[model samples]
Target: MAKRRFGRVRQLSSGRWQARYAGPDNVDRPAPQTFDRKKDAETWLVQKEAEILAGDWLDPDAGKIVFLEYARSWIEERPNLRPRTVELYDYLFRLHLKPTFGARALADIKDAHVRRWRKDLLDNGVSAVTTAKAYRLLKAIFNTAVDDLLVRRNPCRIKGAGQEKSPERPVLTVAQVYALADAIEPRFRALVLLGTFGSLRWGELTGLRRRDVDLDAGTVRVERQLIRITGQGLVFTEPKSAAGKRTVVFPELIAQDLRAHIKDFAQDGDDGLIFVGPDDGPLWNSNFNRRFWGKALTDAGLAKIHFHDLRHTGNTLAANAGASIRELMDRMGHSSTRAAMIYQHGSHERQREVADRLDSLARGQLKSGSGTQRARKPKKAE
Candidate 1:
């Protein structure tokens, strides 16, 4: 019963070894539970001592911080995050995470809790994609807690819980694209053309100015996007990534249409907005989606088509036009290959074209061989 150098271990009446250590606060604390053997208890004490020496030791009681408090603090401390990204994280917390684990202590969240939360989300009619996003957000927050030594390990270990398996979106054909452009109001026709041909995003298209489009040069410069942050209204910020800042060549097929749109619809001055609503202000996706997008689709007889599908159409067309992965990435303003690769998948029609070409080549070779065999048959024994 002599005092040890760092801590002490003693056998309880039940023959289990118990370890106690003096924490950084100078208060003696017992291990959460008893160990089966004295060796195990001694090993645990050694780790605790090492953690103290390395200044990585966190008071066990500190892990009891409420989940919402810690998560909010974690988000607020990231001043470098983009405004839109911060907005999304905030939304996810409010909509998905807060109702479930907000009141729970950070250390009280277990693997079963996370698993049940995910299952409940799915059972409550949440789409699998949304559930996956929520799971990923939770996993990321818990990972940071682990690094801070707030927890021993992350409990979001459910396999494939963080992946989003979105179904393939429908891509508009060339004729459908033109029909949609024609069906929309004359002032907004150019928006459809630019979205479908240039593969521009909603924000990028709305962020355009008179000077951004060059009819003579057949190019459109994407320098910035207009993002509507919560309570901040519409603010102009640079592209989400370096690749997003690009110059896309507008197809000559839409040159006349774009020229007419600029002359008739674009605001006055070089910095004037190119695409605006009926009130001549910047176009907001919410208003557009509510007012015009559905009408345009109905007018064109295109069912189950979303406005963003126009961009998908453009990317698919670009990939079918023999664009390599890097070219597709540059055109789509994606910093990674995964999205560009998805667009680069050979279209059914393009795959059919490949098969047809191979069949034609085989037929031509067979015909040539037959002619050679007839020609070398000693002139038909004449």
Candidate 2:
């Protein structure tokens, strides 16, 4: 390989001091501007030389594609991405990002542009969390452009970049959970109960096959999830994370329900879905929610709650049962303990009980010591 070399200061025909350098391919390249003096030219040459040695130099003008064009190419290149992930990326790009930065050249984009866009989004009644997601999507796109040599750096790296904190989830009472479970139709009874006890995600619960459950062992193996993506209907995929692939041991009531479920409504084959449509195919999540979930809540006379809240209810119940943080984390298949902690915040009554127990134990110990001191008449005299 030819050793990179810096061009010496030379007076241009326009009476300006010019600096040049040999690129990696041994091609001579000139600076965009000529300096007023040899010192200035030498300073420019030194900076360029260092950048070239560090392998951080780019032509800047090369591949100056517009953000829209680069984004399309980026999406196209991700052939191995999950269908759901691709759908979300496409939606984010088209609905949120492209309208803002699509026309701008990748090289011309800067951190200030991103900051301004974020401010505009927040001003337009968009939640901080939404703005943060948009920012993340833009950052990912620009990072891809950088990787593909379409841009120098990601402009989304401005300080204080991230989504705002979401609202805290409300914990449902045990009475409310049981009431909802009771009001739901018999067909969906097991589903509601399982969600309230197992904390299984909607997809994971819907994706369960008969063979994945072992009623005798009182365990349900969660190995897959059913995802419905835009432009693609229903597809079964592995759990979102390794932690999502777990086995949850249900209580005896749940185990008995499973056994009965197998006997009464079980499909012909072991591979048949535990939850299916009237046609015995995979159930559509939207249909299930609209047809059954809403009526169940209304009948139960409870505030309208999301189907996913059952999972939260399960976590709360497990914590109230004195299950440790690690055990709750395992049951919920949470990738991080942080998320499990959010669900483990039990009711105020439970908190008070814990405090009372500790206080009573302390008082008992003090009383015992006091009795011991009184019994030691000689020691008291001393």
TM-score top scorer: 1
Model 1: residues with Cα > 4 Å off, grouped in runs = 1-6, 9-18, 34-58, 361-382
Q: What is the C-alpha lDDT of each candidate?
A: 0.91, 0.81
The TM-score, computed over Cα atoms with residue i paired to residue i, of candidate 1 is 0.88
Query: Candidate 2: where is the Cα deviation over 4 Å?
Result: 1-5, 8-22, 26-42, 76-80, 144-150, 370-382
Q: How close is candidate 2 to the true structure, as a TM-score?
A: 0.84
Clashes of each: 0, 0
Task: Show the lowest summed lDDT stretch of 10 residues, model 1.
Answer: 370-379
**Where does candidate 2 have its weakest 10-residue lDDT segment?**
370-379
User: Candidate 2: which pairs clash?
Assistant: none
The residue-by-residue lDDT of candidate 1 on 1-382, one tens digit each, is: 6667898899999999999999989999999999999999999999999999998888899789999999999889876789998988898899899999999999999999999999999999999998998899899999999998888789899999999999889988899999989898888899999999999998999999999988899999999998798898999999999999999997899999999999999999999999999999989889988889889888999996777888999999998988899998988898999998897668999999989999887778777785344333355664
Count steric clashes of candidate 1. Answer: 0
Best by lDDT: 1
